[model samples]
Target: MQDNLYDCPEYPLLLILSGPSGVGKDTVARMLIERRPDSFYFVVTATTRPPRDNERDGLDYFFVNFDEFAHMIETNELLEYAIVYNDYKGIPKQQIRDALASGRDVILRVDVQGAATVRHLIPNAISVFLTTRTEGGLVRRLHQRKQDTQEGMALRTATARQEMKRLAEFDYCVVNPEGRPEVAVERVLSIIDAAHCRTHQEPVRL
Candidate 1:
């Protein structure tokens, strides 16, 4: 919890990447890490939602039941938490602190709502809102997921529209077109580089 931007480290930044569903936030972040595995640290969030096929605990997510999730919230173990589509999702506070202390830049792929909470908790964290080239493209991508029912899709689209209004809250925006995550990856890396090179910038005071 360092204050005074003058002493901030060039690396070990805690970045929050968020967007409405189907915007390919995860894909873009993955590509960025793949491009520099030694420099980026990916944090798997914790969730009350059950793991999908091939998903593993502590990897894809720290999958836990309602009781466990509640315990975390009660104990103030989560840096931020939100209920998305009726399931709980959160980022563990200690995990993020440990990652940053280890000297690796951390990337958190979080829901738009969860990201908002993180911005307050970590005032200096960089918030990037990822979006598709067009709103229609976002709808198409959500439909292609095949995991959502007709009702669920409708609900998601409505929620996404509401979420889009918060784009102004983010520090930066990156457009991730369908099937082209690398472009977004490079753009994000450039943002990080620019931030690091700035002579007078506030340090991330987490």
Candidate 2:
């Protein structure tokens, strides 16, 4: 293993991963955390949406109600926040700072709008766009999830098309083809590895 030479007392690399709703962002993040839990810290977003059947409070999301979420925003505790389909979602500033202070690579999985917010807030941060190779593949995967009604699916598909147009704004784009999640994870890992080896040894000090 290669050593990080320019390692400061605390070096934090902020990576923002964004994709359309049904493009497997959570699945890819879970795989990375499972592979090397000690090396990376996955930031859990706070959301007003109630926990689903298998979702956990802190694991899947920091589930909060509307009033609590509103207080967080009013207190400026969130680095970035947005309303998605009537639910409020935000990333806490303290959680990100804590992760970075510990010299961990922090990965944030957010929507396209939230990712854009992060980019403006942290200009040096790395941004990646994840998408399916084809529209048909994306639709098929969404159908498999079985969580959306026909109308909901139509809305999501439309939103996905709009999200795809923002791909050019990202630093890197990874094509996540259908039924090949591991491949996508490996590709992202490879990108992270290369990023760490960049000629400029300075990590983004948040």
Candidate 3:
């Protein structure tokens, strides 16, 4: 029985990537998945927001009109959903179910609030919080974005300060240095690898 504990079978892990508004969570998630293409199921989030210049409808997010997104909410089809910057962002339950059922780890990139919600929904999920090296760096990154208005940027920066205090709720934290996404990706990859090596793992609920 003692030896059996060490022989635990590998199960598909549910890895969540979350962070402050301007912390590059999307960039790090994309890089990490591309690093190990065969090992992850990236859950594409559904959003009612318009697609950006470099964003693809289905790839970056399943861009839909408000009615379509609202329907998903009405049907309880989303794992988690939120109103962000006047836009609806959510994760589809079906994608995560299909991915885990097929024996692949799942990755979800969400904001800090969504992360906390996911923790309750999936207690065993391996949640990692990513942030910049300093507050000044984070503020600069937010300011550099083109689409957000001055008011919107100020709101995000304020929310980020509140979100930072919740880091203790996560399993691990990685600071992504300015302009250094590779470093963040490597840190997150290592955390996932370590989780799989644990003798007792939390079973992902969703």
Per-structure clash totals for the candidates = 0, 0, 0
Model 3: which ten-residue window has the lowest total lDDT? Answer: 1-10
RMSD of each: 4.7, 3.2, 2.2
Give each model a TM-score: 0.91, 0.92, 0.94
Q: Which lDDT tens digits does candidate 3 get at residues 1-206? A: 34544466578899889989889988888897799988998999999989889999888999999999989999999999999888999999999999888888999999988888898998889999998889999989988876688898889999999999999989999999888899998988888888888878755665
Q: Candidate 3 vs. truth: CA RMSD?
A: 2.2
**Residue-level lDDT for 203 in candidate 1:** 44
Local accuracy of candidate 2 as per-residue lDDT tens digits, 73-163: 9999999999887789999988888888788889999999999999998987889999999988888888888877899888888988899
Candidate 3: which stretches are off by over 4 Å?
1-6
Please give, for residues 1-206, the per-residue lDDT of candidate 1 as tens digits: 87766654465678899999989887888787889888888888899888878678887799999999999999999888888999989888887777777777889999898888888878878889999888899999999988788999999999999989999999999999778788899999998888777665554555
Best by TM-score: 3
Candidate 3 clash pair list: none
Instruction: Report the poorest 10 consecutive residues by lDDT, candidate 1.
Output: 197-206
lDDT value for model 3: 0.89
Which one is best on lDDT?
3
lDDT of 2: 0.88
Cα-based lDDT for every prediction: 0.86, 0.88, 0.89
